[model samples]
Target: MNPSSDDTMHTLLIRPKAGRLLFSLLCSLLFTLPAHAQEADTARVKELQGVEVVGRHVTGKLRHDSLGGMSLDLSFLDDMPRIAGNADPIRYTQLLPSVQTSSELDAGLYVQGCDNAHNGVSINGVQLYDIQHILGIFSVFNPSHYSRLQFAGSAFTASAANRLGGFIDMQRPDTLAGRVKGELSVGLISSQGTLRLPLGGKSELILSGRGAYINLLYGRWLKVEESAIRYSFCDANVTWLYRPDARNTLWLDFYGGNDRMDYQEDGENYDARLGWGNRMVSMNWEWKRRGLTLRQTAYMTRYGNRFSIERPDFRLRMPSGITDYGYRLSLRRGRWTAGTDWTLHSIRPQQPETEGERQTTTLSATRRHSTEGSLWADCRFAVARNMELLGGLRANVYTIRRSAFFSADPVLSLLWTSGYGQFRLTANVKHQYLFRTGLSAVNLPTDFWLPADERLRPQYAYGLSAEYRTDLIPGRLQLSAGLYYKRLCHQTEYIGTPFELIYGDYDYRKNLISGKGENYGLDLMIEKRTGRLTGWMSYSLGRALRRYPGRFSGTFPAGHERIHEFNAVATWKAGRRWSFGATLVWAGGTPFTPPSYFYLQNGNLLSQFGDYNSGRLSTYIRLDVSATCRIKVHGGRESGLNFSVYNANCRHNDLFWRLKFNNGQYYYAPLRPLPKKLPFLPSINYYIKF
Candidate 1:
């Protein structure tokens, strides 16, 4: 986007808000060095070896943990064990507080009892609608190209509107100055590739791609026929920097992704394909002119998804997508920051649900649409040397065929530095106007299988949190702890589904569901990073509940509610030749269906779930270990091998709860209640870098 036009209009439009202008200028000045400063940062004493410092995050004092647990990267791989080679990012995040995740293959992440759909996830500001990968063993993005990742569990600014759980902000590394670097790897699930280019020294482009062959690798009985099952995806990101001089730099970033899956079953050949690629182009120009400092960021993110299925007898095409365009104009001077934020988002979920009784061939499609606009102002101030205060509010209005939704999300923050540690407190509330179903989710298993309700009301959540950060050994070791309380209302959930909507609801232009929810939880983490022995330990405890449609009553226990979860990761490094790491995670199971004789309810056999997760499943345990060895190649090129084993002990943890007779037997046979474990698969990855 060419931001100059908007910048000029913004300056003129805000000419009357003189007080805000002064405040912004004051805040920018506080982040700048004094006129007489001769040193940049004293910490740049040594050239980091194979270790890269992350970005200069804005809220450094707000978090106390040593980095690894928050956002993983390449350096931490030094001693980690490799299980074949997939480390699911969604599972990795569940180690935090109030987080409850399903089995290993479950792409769904329930935070503090919130449903899977409640969580908001994005890459470089581009929201990811489809999160499942290879039956849920991994994330959609290729891990090889990940940069810096930040996750906030509860309420955030208006930018995070629809979610009940938290916000995940992933930032890619800035384009390297004069290096052309890239990496390629081959693994069990897919073939992966990445390339980082200098782009003639002015800008850089980093692109990555992955293709999976699980359908071909493990075909069902249909494999005997003209069988088919294959999936693949790719992502590209480009960062352009304009550094005409020191103290002034402009940045433009763009990113996109595409994925698809094809399969055929029974004696029939059918194809199911999901595709969505977004373009997020942004430009941020920062400069300090005279005594005033200005930083303006203007960008737009557009996302869309299309699902199409085909067979010899039928054709189904459903497309639903969203386009979001927004910009943040912030000015900081002295100890104050003031800005305005505006955005426009439009969505169209196209689905078709026309069908006749399926004797053999079946096809269906559907859609829904919503558009919204918002405006807001943010303000911050340094009240004292180590204390600060911040506040903001956003007002948004939606346009739809039914009644429109209006909201005003508010944000408040405070920071204090004491002799013991730094305390950060934040109070946030948001009202989200989201469809019970989103079109962007079409590619995943969860997407359009449900129906849509245009009469639904907006959802709301209020969250308050207090966090503390302190250095145990100054810059070496760190510790952090925090408490959170949240209240949610008006969320949606799915109920009974007819067979016609299941296999037939191929076009996700509409969603079918009916239910509401409410929940809250607490979070905590600690870590150590300095020498070769660098890793961290984390623990989370919280709960969330729901009330979905039921024949017996109103709403009941949600499917995602879990009680406790914990994780411990540590590594030891011996010289440059060897390093070993181990990770352990334990969590209580969630509410699920139990087995019992059915009783007539509403003239239909309705078996009770038995105390909503009253039955405990087997505890989960896994040990992952990996070894790293490097050798020099020609032209000073270096290559290494990473071998990892996941679920090293191969414990059969419960994947899903099943039913059995009260006498410990099956409905009519001798089979007793049994717990199913997700299969453990190990992978080896070979990588060559240039």
Candidate 2:
């Protein structure tokens, strides 16, 4: 078949077929019923009582823990205000004081001065590389499938290694041992469904899926031309749990998601297409006794993206992907825990295929295969009646590009409980061997991954933190304050622009540079945990500086650094059926590079940049509001309707600025700045439960 025909087949036939198969499988699992339905229902009541007890214990742990992490329940997210009515975990986490991004349009997370690549995100113990669906607009995680979400700023647990900045972990719900239950939801951007079924006495299944229909709505109702633009995404999840006895349990999990975007310009004779997705499978087993507990897990994960461009005379295709196979084992006795993890990584950074009448060739810049392993041990002990101590150690080994690298990390923490309050001190060291680079300012699918080699060494960091927390009114109000400092080495940064790489050279390594960074900050938060009116207020003051000896000797602010940040969130329960929420945010301007001057060279205008990150964008401010109403449905069921308004005050927060040059002159007129931003948007959603 011809090239155009082949492309059409893949887009129209293959994708739809795969999507149908996934949807069918999920539906079958969700609707399946047990042979002895009446018998199962009789036992479900007793099982539900036990589940409630376990839930209470988990909630208490979150409320009283001194680890300095944020814990959120899925129910809380349903009532929180969001953009476009999309309930995303990452977006909710970004509202915290310790996290910052370049702008509202950027999905990349900058945690405690560390870049997004330095942080790790996991779902059910499996790592994820690409987490966004439409560039920076929405996240791939389905809120309907998650039970709890947690985030740690600096000092993470030993189980989460190979990262320098921080980690985010999401947990799926356990087996629902009660009667069958399901929920269906419809919104402006997407639709989702969830079901939980009890198979028998010891087995249970849960299934969920979400898909976007924006393209269909636009084409049919809005009368949009089909050939102009197109975009869509879908994701599905399945989990099964079996508990044969009181001491042993087993679980199986599967997840798959995909996204695609296509754009065409008739006047310019240009076409561009981008596609990316992730798939994961895992199995876990656990056994517990009086003093000993053991757990094992095995999993496989894949992430990939493809970009293509075609014109009258030129054609190009670029593909990149990463695959991982991993296993983990852990044991716990009393206050001590030990674990080991082994993983094999297969990475294809960038492979370009060019076809034309004059030249046809396929080339790659960096393709790598590697193995990574880690062993860790940790312990917690009570030193006295009021004092406690915790310590851990980890050893890591990485084999990359025919070479091996090894490192050791240590963590320590001290806690003291007094009559007035609690105090904590922590110290840790971390190391990483993997990195990602992107040409666009936003977190797009075009980002590529690379491993450490002779020229590019691994990255490491050292961090220290101290905090004090107190309760003002026992269960009504609380306050926490912390101070932290971190030093990072061998951090990677992209120095060349996207146009330079496309028009000049495709060698990405030659255009990359490494540097060192330092960050110091203070954080303060005041929270009201339980009441009719509940919420939190937080403020952060920080500075992040970087130095690259090879390129420049002077230090400059990091691209994502903000000098000051403040956030306030509140929710009010007006009555049994009415609830309202509001969020307000303000932050300092982000730093950028400004042009020094313009010059004429051979009838072409060229510009030079001044010191790195010397100019600043405008200050950012935004407010969001939401309201929810509960209604009674048939068969004793419940339903809800949610309405939200983003940018309620109509603030024109700048996404980015464009630089304009005057008529063919090198230095004759002032440069004009054009701003692009998102305006006020309103959205609504409805959900029914049975």
Candidate 3:
């Protein structure tokens, strides 16, 4: 029995069911009679022409948003507490109740028990493949270049297609008209600068750049004998906006970034080097008239990495990457929106080459190509005096190696507002055409992207959620609580042993396995949005389970599952020149598979694991605090000095466990133990605006 065939049948059966359900619900709401009917008199209609209903926008605050998501501005993220002189977007999002990280040293986000690869990250309508820098410690997004970030844990809009887990969209700031402003900042690890300049009367340009000098600092002050390590990273972005008339606008954007690391061991005669980067360029045009808006975008993006190791007599090099080219067109009028997007993907898996003193060998795999296209439409309207309904549909098609797959998904959201409280219900279906395979135990740059083909089918998910939000103190305090459930199909994972690469087995396709997953969770938050003190407290309880067809028939904990999570954040303005902030995080242990026992086979010692993700790591806890002081400069300019401490508690949180085998005995050793040394780090930075 082929899994792909089963998946195709299942998709065909579910599409019509989901469509009928959404259509029926929408029809019922649309035809429902109002409590009070108005007379069909022309005089009364004319007299009521000036009357209008006023309420919050559909995409405003999380509590008010129909989709039950969160939105954060750049100002909020910039002032949040951070670690290692890094204040990137992903780090801040990890503090949210519905988001979780695999470990302290990993930057990948596991939203609502979904795999990190299942989530989608986009910037200014362009998708991003490489979102991390410095091996997942920081994100590639430069805070100075973006204006706002939005996240959805479950249900998503029709415009956000082809993702099953969650959605994260980063929007660029609007054109800064009639303004010439910029800022410069210097931190312990990197330096950054930004500038916004108006060009003539109808155009503007913005540029930002950042570079790290950690390698220079280490070499100059903290050099170690018999060993050397070097690492550096840099990123830059440019945005150009032009408005020829009041109703027409154009935009051109570019981004480039890279990270490199090199290590050497003199005693062992070993040298290793790694480098990865991304390049993207996009063009957009928009036209608006009356209440209608039309926009079109074209973009190209590439992400790739290279790794090499050199020993005394042999050397090896591995290279892999992916490239995407796409275009989108969208139109919006009042309460309705429609759009279409088409993208082409090129994937290259890692190919390794080895060179020895006596022989040279090379192993390679064929590159894969695929195409994806989607069309979506949605609208929002009032179903009753105090209720609004939003419904959308998307049709997606993917073609790889001459094989085509189609999926039709439906999304629905309803919100009821009464006084200062709101209730929301949402249901959505999503599908994905690409999957990633690599080592799950560690975060590495060698992961490869693979497209769905004849043997493998696309992944799909069904999500449902209900939420209630109320203002506890009118304009000052807000509270929200929600529950969500998600079911996933046709998920893929690598099932081969981790040592395959050592034996020159570079073909990962053979080890692929298909499975299913289910996740359910509760999210709660209390937030203060005004006054001198503003922050939020969030908590989440969740469970995630997975099962394979034959080999892991019984459900097991997913790799990213956590039973409990809690976060507290606060910022206070002490005086005109001083501000302080703090953040605390506690989470239940992450699940992992440990070796249940070991045996000798054919005079060789081997290890066997229990059920997948059967063991749990130690719980994780961290505290971070920050303070900022403002200084008045000449010409009324201002500068700020920030000081921060990460891991204030000095706890030895274990990142992972490594099994050691010697003399028919096995022992477990902890990696990245924090308590043995002064892992607590303090950093200071200075920023000036002109």
Task: Give the best candidate by lDDT.
Answer: 3
Highest TM-score against the true fold, candidate = 3
TM-score of each: 0.73, 0.85, 0.86
lDDT values for all models: 0.56, 0.76, 0.78
lDDT of 3 at 272: 87
- Ten contiguous residues with the weakest lDDT in model 1: 2-11
Candidate 3 residues 80-162, lDDT tens each?
A: 56566766778878877788755655768889888888888878878888577767878888887777888887656788858
**Cand. 1 Cα-lDDT:** 0.56
In candidate 3, which residue pairs get closer than 3 Å at backbone N, Cα or C atoms, i.e. clash?
none
The TM-score of predicted model 3 comes to 0.86
Which runs of model 3 end up more than 4 angstroms from their true locations?
1-64, 219-228, 264-269, 356-361, 597-606, 633-636, 660-667, 673-675
lDDT for 555 (candidate 3): 88
In model 3, which range of ten residues has the least summed lDDT? 2-11
Pick the winner on TM-score between candidates 1 and 3: 3
What is the TM-score ranking, best to worst? Answer: 3, 2, 1
